[model samples]
Target: MTAPRRPGPAPALDLAALVADPQTRIIVCCGSGGVGKTTTSAALALAAAEAGRQVVVLTIDPARRLAQSLGLVELDNEPRVVETPGSPGELSAMMLDMKRTFDDVVSAHSTPERAEVIFANPFYQALSSSFAGTQEYMAMEKLGQLRASERWDLIIVDTPPSRSALDFLDAPNRMSRFLDGTMIRLLTAPARAGGRAGVRIVGAGFAIFTRIISKILGGQLLNDISAFVSALDTMFGGFRERATATYELLRQPGTSFVVVAAPEPDALREASYFVDRLSTEGMPLAGLVINRTHPPATTALSATRAEAAAEAVAEAGGKGAKLAAGALRVHAERMTLATREQRLADRFTSAHPEVKVRTVPAAAGDVHDLEGLRTMGEALLAAEDDTGTGTPRSRVLPLRPQAG
Candidate 1:
């Protein structure tokens, strides 16, 4: 049998070329929460800009870090330029506002009077602003709009950190669920030519609930719902088609997904789940970024010292010494555990040898601006010295931007 191939040895990634590639229009940065997915998205955009490519980064990370990463106080639907020193490419960023995107869709498709009617509708408002899939669907809508605008050469997206990052992928189906569900038919029951009297009676009963909610919320809920349904009756097909197109766009080759994971087991498992789902949906899983990984050290000296400290504490036979030794032991164990996790990651890389594996060492500080992103890119594609030597040094691995 052919010797099993090793995980395509982590290759040096050319992020600029990836952004400049005529084929790649979208880059999705996804992972579980708190793994620096937002930072990675910004850094990728900044790196592309450094390489002289026009890029835009969009995110729904409500943590406000997206604003700070671009060194802005706030964000809205509009993209803002991020100027970094010594960077030749242009970069723009925006934090997605779900409500704004939703409103835009209505305004785009309907006249002001119709939009007012739709916006005032109780069910329409709830479905637009407060529903589970509304935000995700709006995000895709934003992506589609940006793609059509051709304002930026590259659109890098950071999805909401979700228990299932694939929530984004399911958004279209979820939106359709609202219209395709029994509730719509129940409301639209009057629009159908069933027994008119019974339909009116049932509709009147629904109106009672609508009026009560309107009174409680201080909005004309019934009128809004009626108007919204009336307008939506004319626009449902448009909404359905837009959502469908967005879903298709996500799965296309022009879009590439970067799955992010920290060294922790839970994060790795989440990444693995996301990878599997992306594969199932036929979305391109461009590569993986194993972040905050502990690099190996050259000093066999420190490891030896840690061992001696434990031995001395045992010999000393005192509480204070034991406590200090315990701390040392904790540090050593942490490093040992990190090494084991890195090995586990390597196994995954080996198994998916075709997938590029980039390791990003835990950076020293929080990323809050254009400069921070530049610093991040350094570690991402930093070169290694002739390490054919004996000492095992820590290496920084970044997620590959494009696999070639």
Candidate 2:
């Protein structure tokens, strides 16, 4: 029988290598909820600092618990400094506030009078504050700001836990539904176009729909929507331009997107879909970071023997022995899963030889501070040195010019 072998601890990571790579400018961390993506972003920044690069880490909708980890009280657009130990590198972080970003954009684009009118309009207000794609747009906006900054050398972004990771990937176009679409005019038929067949039909439909809506929220609501749309009539093209620019920025040679996922089947599947989606859009596919990998207890035959002995003890009714064996079994199972992870990773490695691969083991506690970030950086950087002795590393990264 093949003896179970313990997997060695991953070697120290070389964060400096990733950031310093000529083609890499951005590192985006994405995964399902509760997968430690937020922590990963911070850790990369800390690691990058050790490598001697100035890093700015950004997060959208970070949990309160993790906000504590990143040394932030709450979400804000402004960046805060993060302390990195045993390194002279600089790091910063921010939690995105989508509503704030919208308000800022509106304030920038319109007169105070027009801004208030739009802000007070329920429909316009809802679109800005409660809309689905607001987070994505705001994230893009934040990236734009970071890219323009002279303070940092790198930007690490963590996306919200979304049903479709592509949501952020496609957000700019989706949010401006009214701009490119003629459906709204069709839906809100006016009495002016009476002679045309299509106008007449639309008017009749509008009459019935208006009456129903009038009874529910009153006609005032529709008036507000119309007014808001009119005031913001010129904003659509600009919004599209901004979104396109951000999308192009992602594809630049300097921006490197790190697709984050776990070893679990669903997360792995999501990672694959994201890869396919980015590839289809011609986005830069920098590399992949697999988190929460299980550590193996032994190597080769020793691991197999431990598993067998553990199973034998359980079969022999040695409850105490079984418990001891269970730990080894868990480790064995993780390594088994790790092998599967390796296979999937290998698939990518073989196909995209230029893309770098980084793996981080599951940490004991959730990361919440600069110190915790340093620990994560250490874990992420572990595989570079099997002997558990390596210096922290950071790399100076640049923003790929916004895509034209």
Candidate 3:
């Protein structure tokens, strides 16, 4: 009987090449919370800048990790240039201020008087700041604005840390639907009719309906919403149009989505969802990045053998033997952890064999500066074998002990 062939490692995701390509205008890093999406986006942007591409990274994460990593005091709605000494290209970074972005959209599309009316509305104030999906929608709006400017060769997007990774992809459509939905059209019908006709449009039946809605929503709140809708009546079509355009932009050839996840079951499952969604939406997917993986320093010694050696050394009971045994125990523990991580990664690979993947070993400390980011960037771009054994350069065995 013929033996079953063992599956080879997943195809390597050449992130370096992906960023270096002039045609790659946008790279969006998205995944579940605490998966290093912010760090990955910053590192890739720094790497691309050093490689001579004019790069801008926009982070929607509220944690401000990206600012710290980029060595910036603070980041706001506007793009701020990051000083990269001895680099061939320039880099800029920004954090999405959703409220400001929403205001900008209104001001840009509306007459000054009308914009003032919309901005001063209580409902608009609430909507711009804390409405459901506003942050995600504005992130898309900011991305669309950045792309339309044609100022940078590459735009790296760090998606928001939402409950669901799909929120980012769903934002534009959600916003478009909100603007064009039946209820919104009904609310603004009076405003569209104008003056006396506006009053006539809200006749006995409509007045009764409004009264019922007022009882449910509170009369003041409903009035505020009607006023807000009235002020925004002319700009609704513009909102829907821009949202549709941005959604289409995500599906274009120049854009690529990199799903980032840690080497754990839940994170990898989220990555799988994102990968499948990207395929369904026809978005260009660059690959998967498995971050903070615990690959063993040396795979030559199996965990079982390491444990046995440690036990034997401890039983011998020499002066330095205790220390040596401790070291061996530590190595054994590391090997065990690495094995678990690898198994989890393998399960993901088995499910998604065609997706290219790159694994980054866990850093000894958090990356909080440009130098640390560069180190992470190096690790991200490091080549790995077909067996996914991690970076070959760092996989050396321990040196032999000297005999006294």
Candidate 4:
């Protein structure tokens, strides 16, 4: 057996090269909620499009930020071409509408008569709209559809803001289990078997089981579920197959997973979980993005020295003393924050030393337009410093001018 690979310092993630490559077809941005996955996805798409690659970004996030940034009044289930002036290539975007996508799948796969029946079923309505895991499953379905269209050179996916970042990856298996499960088989048995054989197949135990479930779910609801199961029976295998295909698409060579996180402990912990899960699932992890870092504008002054200087200036009580002291104190606080962020980052790197990382400094305000997204994209692809300073370009600051 081969020896285990040893961990080493993480190489800088060259996002520019990754997006520029024609072979890189799909990039999935995933992390815990509120880590800027949507922005990151949009920025990556913008970068690739400006680089002359046709791109479409699918956002599972419900927020209107992506649409706003792209200059669209709104986004829906269908892809809308974005007007990117001066860009050689094209860009399009869409938000996932789980219910509509589910309807499309049913309508596409079933006869009109059957489709209407399934659409009318109460169980189908509930499952398609608010069912657990439905969003994730629909995301997979939409992604598969986009890939089959062959309409774009690159696809960027911003995964849903779910409780767990791995929900997107688990969607296929969850769908498969639900479709082929014993519970579903039992639910549809009466419709499939019919008449006396159906009753015989169900027997006394099943009859009692159904009665208990009926009491809990109400007879009408139980009947609706049984009807829904029977109507969807023919399409069950199709759902499982499609989900499997999409899952495989994610693991393909052309696909890449980018874990987005903040410098905070909780966010980094979630990133670590995502990284570990991606490794376990054999997914191709491109790298990790530490977003919205508070890097100090200058590293020449240490926090201790800044605090000492502030105290000395306050004691001197000379001209501009209060203002100078306040400025130094502010710098001291900033330095302290930067130190904490770097310490947290180092902790993460020490654990997963082989994972590449790219840090994006926090913007002064929210990015709400194409130009802002372009700026964010440039920061993502900034060159890394190699002078043993352990500082990313986004985190580096010019030295302060010396006194005359």
Where is the poorest 10-residue window by lDDT in model 3?
392-401
User: RMSD in angstroms, all models?
Assistant: 6.8, 8.7, 5.1, 5.2
TM-score of structure candidate 3: 0.91
Per-residue CA lDDT of candidate 2, range 179-230, in tens? 5566456444453356689776877787777787678877887777667777
Tens digit of per-residue lDDT, candidate 1, span 287-368: 7877777654432435457767888887888768878888767666655755566566766655555666566767778888
lDDT of 3 by residue, 12-79 (tens): 78888888899999999999988888999999999999999999999888888998999999999999
> Candidate 2: TM-score?
0.76
What's the lDDT for candidate 2? Answer: 0.67
Q: Give the winner by lDDT.
A: 4
Ranking by TM-score: 3, 4, 1, 2
Candidate 4 backbone collisions, by pair: none
**In order, how many clashes per candidate?**
7, 35, 0, 0
How many backbone clashes can be found in candidate 1? 7
Q: What TM-score, over all chains together, does every model reach?
A: 0.79, 0.76, 0.91, 0.90
lDDT of each: 0.74, 0.67, 0.84, 0.86
lDDT tens digits by residue: candidate 4, 1-404? 66644333456788988999999999999988888889999999999999999999999989898999999999999999999999999999999999999999999999999999999999999999998888888898999999999999899998866545468678878977887787787887666676886678676556877899898999999889889988888998888889889999989999999999998999999999989999999999998999998777667788899999999999999899999999999989988887787777767888988888888888989999999999999889767773244555533232233433
Q: Which residue ranges in model 1 land beyond 4 Å of their true spot?
A: 1-17, 192-226, 299-338, 350-354, 383-404
